[model samples]
Target: MSQSTDFDLTSSQTAEFDLTTVAFKSNPYPILARLRTHDPVYQYTSSPDGQSTWLITRYEDAEIVLRDERFVKDKQSTLPPEERAPSAGPAPSVSDLFDLGMLKFDPPDHTRLRKVVNLFFTPRATEQWRESVQRISDELIDKVESQKRMDLIEDFASVLPIRIISEMLGVPAEDSMQLHLWTKRIADALDDPAAFEQVASDLQAFYTYLLALVEKKRQASTDDLVCKLMHASVEGDQLTERELVAMIFLLILAGHETTTNLIGNGILALLTHPEQKQLLQAQPELIKPAIEEFLRYLAPFTITTHRWAREDVEMRGKLIRHGDAVLVSLAATNRDENKFDHPDTLDITRQENPHIAFGKGVHYCLGAPLARLEGQIAINTLLRRLPAMQLDIEPEALVWRTGSTVLGVNHLPVTF
Candidate 1:
């Protein structure tokens, strides 16, 4: 990677930072900015109960690391056999095992898995889902409009994506409320160790619920995604039962989490910054660029991608040891001073806004088109439909999610 930031990994001293605390939780922008400028290749070591990982915050470094295949995703292959198995004694839930969805796979596996999922979202295929997406958004806003200062998260953002994904998977709307809670709990547990046991339990329940749904799909002939996978074959290879379950888990959570934050955070940003909101309201055509800028401006996934160094590779002028976790802080990178001019400033009309919020390389997010369509439809429709859309409370008064693994506000109360 060019424009390397040299650092000696061996002799480095560590800093104390709890990724899941109120300070970092309430606001991470300042910390991200500080790390981006000062400690670009910062190694965050644990104090007592905390776990340590290297945090790469700069634009160039994040781009280089996220795209580099040498920093691999299949750290499972490198794990000790004891660590590989779930406790080595009892076989655990599917979540405990190496869940190799498209995100978990590397290279050829990643390519193949992504291709199968991409078939559902390709430009040609996406047109069919548009009507469904629009219908979902309108119904959601209808609910939102009727509420007494509804939360941007629970009332709108979180539910819309869940409905879209659940319906896509042929999961009945009756099942959506529980499934959405499970997904949120799973995300919460991932970000906060305090929530791990509860999260794992929720995950098991989610898997169990999904299994029943899969069985229904198996017996019936439906055009939902689970059936699509059941019938699909690639390179003469059909997906195994375990793989199918894993795919459902991955797709639902991935689709639900990131886009929810996009809608929630995007709304927060526009509401917080009135001038930008006014500009968009004046010219709704800017929604496309505005969405791109929003993704960059408030990147949902803090560290969207993580990898382990393959074989002691030299990147950013640092010798990263094999099996070491390399994280690209997309949250920090999106507002990177080098990659984006006025990175912290949100400009809906910016000529060039290249953000890695959807990720990069062969592992780019397949659902990006669908997410964009959903986001644009939601934002534009809200502005046009809501008689006088505005935040009912101060931006600071809203409760930003604590230990938010993927950055989002828990509550965004609004009035129309």
Candidate 2:
């Protein structure tokens, strides 16, 4: 790793950089760069809960933590008996509903849960949805084309993936907005603890809705993905009722959120770099590589979901004790000076790209192929149809959505 004398953050200086701040969320690259350089394994403490989490910033160290089996996802399993006591009340918190999926498990359980739906998300299977994705992208643009000005996020980026995923999961198109609202609330609660009480009703409503949907699928013989999951059995083991709800919940949230941000962020990147946009327009075949570049330049997922240390482990010069939470900054790692040349530059034609935007190891995103397909189709369709499209507001004036795991603008106002 090369050392730079330009900027350095001492341990004390690092503590001042809160990850949850709106400023950090809007532009985290500068802070993350300093962390990677001065403190690769930096420790961050949340002011709300007084819980400490180790932030792994460098590319190599982040990869190590991701691939290392010692660093697990199930924090409960690693907790001491005293810390694992059951709650006195039965009220469900955001974690109760959101963390029950495969993303929160490890080993046999994660493997089993993932295997049940693995085939549905493979590259070949995802290719079958290209026509549907193209149709949805076109329809979304067609609605706004006549208007000449539209919030790209509200009208197009956020709607396309939800529609496709809803159709695949047999969820009614009418329920997409409600589901999106519930998912956003859940994510907000996770990001800001104080918001939990306000969104509790939403959490319960979402859970109840999914439960009813599962039972509905159970009674009828449908051909959607939900029906297939209901009947899918791996090694004579079927998904339990809770598991089914959790799986469906995970699919709905993960299915659209990442892809939504990808389209939004990718468009913004191209709009800011007009040359790259023109490059893609001149050679439409560059869409695939351009999508990859967008992901590398600005990953939709800024940091990974928390991973817990099962036992005391050391990375770099810092020690992460047992039961400690660790977060790998995918956004930071993608821009590591050692990983990619001109890491900060937006180069659509660059070839040596190896980004872990969807994550790595066993927990690598299952819907990556689908997300890429949607991004390619969405961006290509927009450029082809709206040749004069440009950002309506200055880049700095755009408001980025906060209190969520996904990194994207709240509204991408654009005009052609």
Candidate 3:
């Protein structure tokens, strides 16, 4: 059934949008547009906080909210909770991510940290890693070359980026494999509130683990980015130890999480859409466009730009109260009717996507270039090298991640 036809929006409970709407999570565009017709900026009830927040579904409206100064992206600017949020649960990795370094700060701090990160991850910097990325992609593929069946998630996507990040961070190239457990536990916890508590514990453990590594990087300096960050000054100011750890955590998080999802989602999309897959096979030259199309099609980030309105601001006729959390729905805006000619169709050759997959404005993703290079090289290599690769499991047999605001897949069993 169509996402719109699946719902009875007139019902009182249904009128108040809940995140449980599977259609909204997996494919929310139809319902989002239906609601946008009357309330482009609707108040959506979030399961995480158990409160209502503004949600913009239209491409134009969402863009305005993302770029506008009135809606503060920093959560600290909001009324600090009546009390500090109860931290008693799984790992509180996201909270740590924003608080530890650049992700948390506003203007001067945000700009400073971002500038430092950009120095190493910029497009030119990304080009420097092209050969390294391609080598890693080719090497990883070779591992599963003869295997008739493999779990693409763990065996491939999950491992590749993390391995590179470990090396890039001046991390002992061999011990990078250790980050595997930390990334997984932290990623899983972000979705489950119960898991979130565990995340707190895990985060402490990760900190202990990284503390040693940071000390090591400090002692044995090299020319690598991590070493560079160790000595680099931001706007004539040096990063404190606390700030450095946060920066490292951000690198590992971005390095591993985003690209893993990007590849997983891209692989899943190709398997599901035979036409698009065949199109890529027919014209290999379209890999660049196809990669962008796939990222737009997958859209893994689940509203990273969560904010609280500084004051009551009207968005598309909706009253956004002061101090209300505003969650930007990227999946909704990417498919907005006004944004694309054929919004839902998997058009690999699509041009002018300019989707918010990497986010927009000052808060835009710093690792986009690296993610793109990794994705383009990875996807192109997989297509070229694994010509016989096809899904080993049935479509119905697949299972999606739980409470993953940003998701790819749990497993993609494929055969060569």
Best by TM-score: 2
Native-referenced Cα lDDT, model 2 = 0.84
**TM-score against truth, every candidate:** 0.90, 0.93, 0.89
Scored against the true structure, residue 234 in model 1 reaches a CA lDDT of: 65
Instruction: Report the lDDT tens digits of candidate 1 across residue range 1-416.
Output: 11234433222211214555545655677777877776687665422455455678887877777787777777765576676643212443656323556677787777776666677877677667778877887887877666646777888888888998888889999988898888877776564556676676777788788778878888887988889987787677676666777788888888898889888888888887889888998999999999999899887777765687766776545567778777778778888888889888988888798899998888888888878888888888777777366788876676655553677777788887
Question: In model 1, where do residues sit more than 4 Å from their true spots?
Answer: 1-16, 46-51, 79-92, 96-98, 144-148
Tell me, by lDDT, which candidate is best. Answer: 2
Per-candidate Cα lDDT values, in order, are: 0.75, 0.84, 0.73
Q: List model 2 lDDT by residue over 1-416, tens digit each.
A: 21223444655545546665566777888878877887778776654567887878888988888989999987777987777744212553435455668887898878998998898999999999999999988999889899999999999998998898998999988999888888766664565677667888887898889888988888886999999888898788787677778888888888778888899999999999999989999999999889999998989877888899989997776678988888898879999999999999999998999998989899999999999999999999999999999999999998876663678888999999
Query: Model 2: runs farther than 4 Å from truth?
Result: 1-16, 80-96
* 1 against 2, candidate with superior TM-score: 2
Full-model lDDT, candidate 1: 0.75
Span of ten consecutive residues with least summed lDDT in model 1: 7-16
lDDT of 1 at 395: 68
Minimum summed lDDT over a 10-residue window in model 3 is located at 1-10
